[model samples]
Target: MGDVRVIEVKQSVFAENDRRADALRAELKAHGTFLLNLMSSPGSGKTTTLAATFKALRGRLNMAVMEADIDSDVDARAMDELGVRAIQLHTGGMCHLDADMTAQGLRGLEALATPDAPIDLAILENVGNLVCPAEFDTGASANAMILSVPEGDDKALKYPLMFEVCDVVLINKIDVLPYFDFNLERCRERILMRNPHAKIFPICAKTGEGIEPWADWLVASVRAWQA
Candidate 1:
């Protein structure tokens, strides 16, 4: 007879992470907080957009931001100065934040939110890296990608999965469109082809151009999600 087989089960690579994400989602729903996972490459205006967006929506929404970076707290500091409850998550050299990291951030924000108003909005500015971050679920109500004109319009074709998974796409740095060869129509066409349900908004974060509509759509979206 063959020797008795022995099998040792091991920890799930995504066990704690998925659990935390589920809990975080439940907590946010209870607090009426809408979470948006903003993802993009470095210099894609993710931070700039958040700074401007939170500033615009503060009076109307109880907003907070969770900034994720590999090392620096600079983005978090900037968002804090804007009067939004902001916190920095250092991934300690990790390329991306899993559900576990976002759960901790949610707890911190929960502590700050008032019980009455609670946190109606939680913007999670994901790590600068695009590919890895896109792979992890951070317990956000929606996934958004900011693609700057400088990054070129062909991005959707190259990183198909990111565009495929995102619910919204922000075409940032549009004010500089005159300099770049980015064709807005082509970008929209390609991205929409990949994600038929995606809502695309073009805006220049520095000049605050086209922000109102974007923020409006965002607010309406969150409200609809609550409903």
Candidate 2:
């Protein structure tokens, strides 16, 4: 061949993104904001769990939500109807939000905060995908994932990285535990095998069966992060 060229920018790209993510995290901490990047598969009751958290902690803290998805503003609209400061990030076919994308989304959602309406906690409801989302850090102070009872107990074995990276895991839709084949013990054992320090909570988002403790822990963690 007369001329040949090869270029590899993957490492540089990721390094730059990681640098930006660190800066974003520092900026958020300076403003006393705790960003939580929540991930889960579609139909895992992430939105429902968020609603429960809101109800459980309303008027208790300054909170906002950023809903990320491939398309549709349905979740954002739902948050808005609740009178919560919310923004929607459309990934335009991207299955996950990387650090740079998260920074951009935060910029778009900036209008939600002001001196009179400051944000103490900003929840980034990440796109529905256990794979790509778990591979990227969105500069969140804490990360959480939802695993509904209907999703089966073998998820930890199939999606080890997701469970391993999260600080907390919420087992949603526990009201149907009797009907589903989900085994709490087996799931916990598998998750622990991957992430020994993972905090697991079994709850029903619709009825708020076990949401109080989760909400309480969230509030405390936000405070500690701010500190």
Candidate 3:
């Protein structure tokens, strides 16, 4: 029998994406912009959490948001109303944004920036999906994901790669924790098991509770990244 050849298309694609992501990171460093990739499943209050975060860090940082979705401008409109430079990136049925897509979004945001308000922090609100987003490197300085209380505590176990890749995980909707039966401590434990270095924040985005620490961490991270 003749020898069979196998092509590792996925591996090659990931390698190329990783290289492009590294290049994008260097470019962002040169521009002094910190790109944060935020991921979560649908109904995780991702946009609400961003609104709270925007309110918290509004004056401290010149920020912009790129809301990525398969098809929707709602989040982009919501963010723009917050008085920040916000744009929507349509993924065109793609479940995740790759480095190239992220770079395009950044360019759109850069065009929206002004001399007085250059983007120091560019946030990529990735498509609302846990799996594909985690698998793709979107050239972000740091990766963050939100797991709302209603999503349950075992999400870390089910979506281990998502937890493992995230630099931070915001346990949003804490105000409803009482009704959801979600174990915060156990969730933290599971996340730590997946990623010991991840910073966990228990926050109620609706009520603005437990947001300060997360905001402070973000501010520190941006400042450090710029430095």
Could you say which candidate leads in TM-score? 3
In terms of lDDT, model 3 sits at 0.91
What TM-score does each of the candidates earn?
Answer: 0.89, 0.92, 0.93
lDDT of 1 by residue, 123-142 (tens): 88888876888777888888
TM-score ranking, best first? 3, 2, 1
lDDT of 3 by residue, 76-137 (tens): 66677676778888787888999999999999988999877778888899988999999999
Question: In every candidate, how many clashes are there?
Answer: 0, 0, 0
In candidate 1, position 56 carries an lDDT of 71
lDDT of 1: 0.84
What's the lDDT for residue 44 in model 2? 94
Clashes of 3: 0
Across residues 160-209, which tens digit of lDDT does each residue of candidate 2 receive? 89998999999999899899888999999999999999999999999999
lDDT score at residue 178, model 3, on the 0-100 scale: 78
Q: Candidate 2: deviation at residue 95, Å? A: 0.8
